[model samples]
Target: MSAVPGTVQTVGLFAGQHVLAELEGVDPALLDDEPFLRRTLAEVLDLAGATVCDVISKQFEPQGVTVLALLSESHASVHTYPERGALFVDVFTCGTRAKPERAVELLTEALRPTSAQVQTINRGEAEAPADGHREGAS
Candidate 1:
């Protein structure tokens, strides 16, 4: 049997997932606040259903704040550019325990951007051979 043209067959011990979101016309004031961003990250992680390990946030000299959340399944990060009124978010999880899209949605809602673009990619997908043969086949 053959798979459909648009379908994918995945076989792997781990599922590497990633979500990237680009937000435009966000509130610049919110982007510059370190405490707010930190808190927001925690909320986002919770929304994604991931186990939180540690969080580290830093504010730049002139402006902008970068927040990174270290999750037990993987990691989530956000970087803000206040001057351009834009922010970029990255969320990656190793297994099914986390939902990266939910995390992105939470961040977008908290930022309230005028326009947002989101992308989801399945990384490290392993597929079986097309010949229908296994390693132990005689």
Candidate 2:
């Protein structure tokens, strides 16, 4: 929605997908490998139709790893808990340039989680108020 001359746009116009995944029984060693995680994340981004601009991964001293991919459309990330044999993943992309679900799928394959729970959300779907009133405004 476009802003009128004197009124403000009370909602967003862009459409994006956000995928949240909870993984269990993952391989602890895989979650601690920075290089492997980075490469795998890059491949996942490519498979999801996202252009990867850059990637950052970190490994904790005791255990676990975190990988973040900065995509042209948006960002994808993974946080691992090797001790718990679990991980949390988030993939968000704007427009139709990428598929967040595909990314999560690939991650599930690479991590080999025994059980997984995924939640997908459609962002920026609210209709803008013609009267220029926000959602909570009376």
Candidate 3:
């Protein structure tokens, strides 16, 4: 039974976690240092159990930096605003091998922001109801 062109095939269930953080009142110098930011991200991912594949970064004129790490589990990134002393950090990992939340936490620690806003998102299949209760059998 094989008769299809551009058909969708089931590939089991998928699950992943995404962690986002907004760090404020950080040191502008740290935010503009591309090399240090890249190294920090790589080390953070490793400590969070993520395998680093490749890293790419750019240093902006005036002041700013963006560092991205491609990971075996998924990927992680950081975008900085040196003028404002703030940065946005994101770490996402597929499957259960890595901890995205820990990555964010470690990032927060490394940056030492005056304040941090963090959010955790559960992605992929088999999510519970939004109201936090399973539907009764019908």
Candidate 4:
């Protein structure tokens, strides 16, 4: 059904948080920096108290980067588009232990995107994530 605004609603089966962001106008260099992205994602996840199992990243031939982390709670990832000076981030976690939304905020703060579109959702709930910021974020 529908989640009542201003009230916390219980999810059907999985009580999880999923944060998806679209960050635009980020530094192209930062977008292409696989090391920085990897380290930042790892550090933020850690700060969020997530148990990171492993992190894998790939630097594209011409540009761009993709960093994905396997978390004991779930998964977090970033896909960059250097040519467009943008990136897409996803932080999904099971249960209430990990602060997935905080992770996204950290990523956004670090990337310093000119425009950000971020969405947070309660998994198995019917309500769509409310728009926060421009479409560039999530």
* Winning model by lDDT: 3
Using TM-score, give the best candidate's number.
3
Over the stretch 4-90, how does candidate 2's per-residue lDDT look in tens digits?
Answer: 787776433477899999999988888778899899999988998998999998889888899999988889999989898899999
lDDT of 3: 0.90
User: What lDDT would candidate 1 get against the real structure?
Assistant: 0.87
lDDT of 4 by residue, 1-138 (tens): 448767876643356889999999999999999899999999999998788999999999999899999998899999999999999999999877789998988888999999999998888533344654534455
Write model 1 residue lDDT over 1-138, tens digit each, in one string: 328887877532366789999999998999899999999988888878988899999999799999999998889999999999999999998867688899899888888999999999998644435896656666
Ranking by TM-score: 3, 1, 2, 4
TM-score of each: 0.81, 0.80, 0.82, 0.79
Relative to the true structure, how large is the alpha-carbon lDDT of every model?
0.87, 0.88, 0.90, 0.88
Of 1 and 2, the candidate ranking higher by lDDT: 2
Error of 3 at 59 (Å): 0.6
Number of backbone collisions per candidate: 0, 0, 0, 8
Clashing residue pairs in candidate 1 (N, C-alpha, C atoms within 3 angstroms): none
Clashing pairs in 4: 21-137, 21-138, 22-136, 22-137, 22-138, 116-137, 117-137, 117-138
Error of 4 at 73 (Å): 0.7
lDDT for 94 in candidate 2 is: 84
Alpha carbon deviation, residue 15, candidate 4 (Å): 1.5
